[model samples]
Structures are given as structure tokens and as C-alpha cells.
Target: MDETHRDRDAEGRARNARPRDGLGRPLPYGTEGVGRQPEGVVRSPEETLREAQRLLDGGMPFHAHEVFEDAWKSGPEEDRELWRAMAQLAVGLTHAARGNAVGGARLLRRGAAVLEAYRARGPYGIGVGALIGWARELAGRVEPPETGAVARPAGRGRATGGVDAAAEAPRLRP
Candidate 1:
């Protein structure tokens, strides 16, 4: 047997080679080395939003936020504003994960404000639309107790429970 047949786990622990799939076989030749992209395709604003959503799904909110920042900076001015807002929201969530509720809420409000500023424009795009709703909801919730934290303004609770952040951001390449 060739050494190439050997397989190892992340820690280099040799284990039983289980069947690749339900069929009990290895992946096809052309697909063996294929990997998912950090960000997905971005043919348009909608697609880019979807990519950011994928990052969110994978629990890489900071990375997702970075992706959105790239998209926002490269996008047109009108589109940039909304993208930046969404990016900020992603960052806010990251802050929340670190127990910085005040900072999170602050970023969330800023993002919501950006979106609200453009609510009248045609199609805030799916990612931003959902984010706007989320930011608004987050704005209303009492800030989690943080040392030396100051209270921030409450968000206006608008209809719509808020978009699913996971579904809203997806990995995409533009």
C-alpha cells in the first residue's frame, strides 16, 4: 500500500478511515481538494450581502464585518452607506460576544441610523433591510450591565422581528 493512502485527523491522530459519504467512498477526483470560499460570489449588492451572511452563519462575525467593509468601500456612495451600516451591525454583534453590550448597542444604533436614513430609497437590499430591523430591536433592549457604561438611546421598535442575521450574511467573492 502506498503511504498516500494514510489519513490523519487535525491532531495527526491516525484513526479508522470512515466512508467519505453515505455511499462509503472517497470524494470524486475533481472535488477532493475543493474548499468553500471565505466569501462567496458578488455579482451585485444582493449577492455580496448574501456572502456576508455566510460569514455570520459560520460565527465569524468580525470576519463578516470586514468583508462587508470591503464591499462597502468599493460600492457606490449610495450603496456604500447601507453596506457600512450593516458592517457596523456585524461589528456590534462581535462586541456583544465580548461582553461589551454598551459598545455593541452603540454600533447597532449607528448602523440603524444609517439604514433609516436611506429607508426611503428603493430597496435597501435584503442584508441591510434585515439588519435595520435587528438594530432597531437591539436598540430597545436594556443595555446589559457593563462596568462604567453609560446608557444609550433606545431604539424605536418597528414592526418585523428583525431579519435573521445568519441568513442575511453569506460568504461571497466580488
Candidate 2:
């Protein structure tokens, strides 16, 4: 067998080895590990927030979802809702990437609702509010660019506004 074939088999084996969870035992993606944050480590919410934003901005919504999930797990249950909303938004984007616009919209709207609730609670309200708007905009298909141009694959690295990526995404009904 060729080295490429061996590599593919190894990858398949590794994927098969991962443990499953209640949700069909799907393996967690992106994160190296799961742990409750320990003592003596200074936490920077802004950094955590920024990292999530950066992943989303760079078009790696799956990774972004993982980052926000970590943040959610580390936070108090009350504050966790905000992070959960963020994580859900990332997941929505991932669904969008997979062409599931309807699934994405459902998740985004749910997250936005959670974010709005958090916003009314004060403290981290401002941050949650900002993201809520973003989620709403995404769910509603508001233009991502001011010029109404959403770059889409023209063939390879090239892209054009003629193709509506948002419109092309799959729409799933509840």
C-alpha cells in the first residue's frame, strides 16, 4: 500500500477511537482537552472574547465555537449563558459554511435571544448586546458588507459578488 493509503487508514482509526457523548457520542472538535480552569491563573475575558471573534473573522467558525465553549464551561452558570450564546453563534456560522442556512438561522436566533436576556441582566450586558445584534443580522441575512458584495468562490482563490453565498446556503425548516 502507498504511504498516502496508510495515512488515510491511520486517520480513520483515530477518528473511530474518539469517545462519544450523549448527543450521539460525537467527538468534541478543535479543543485539545476539557478542564475546569484552575486557581492562580488570571482570566482575561477580553482576550477570550477576542480569540472567539478572531476565529470567526478568519472564517474558522468551528474553532471559534470551541473557544466560546471553553469560555462558557469556565464561567458561572449565570454568566455562562452569554458564552453559550456566543458559542451557538459560532456553531450557526459553521452550519452556514456547510450550506445549512436554515439550521444556521435557527441557532443564530436562539443565541440572539439568550444574548438579549443576558444584556438585560447588567454587568456583561454591553458585550452581550453587541454580539446579539451580530447574531440577529446574520440570521436575517443582512448584508455582511456595506457595498452589498459578499465574496464567493469564482473558481479558485478568486471570488465575485455575483454569487450570493448567503442565498446559496441550505435552508432547513424546523
- Top of the candidates by lDDT: 1
User: What TM-score would each prediction reach against the true structure?
Assistant: 0.55, 0.55
- Per-residue CA lDDT of model 1 for 19-88, tens digit only, reads 3321113454334431323433343666666666666776556666767777777777767887787788
lDDT (10s digit) by residue, model 2, range 8-76: 234465223233331112344433332222222323566666665555555556666677677787776
Return the TM-score for candidate 2, rounded to 2 decimals.
0.55
Error of 1 at 35 (Å): 12
lDDT of 2 at 139: 66
- What lDDT score belongs to each candidate, Candidate 1 first? 0.58, 0.54
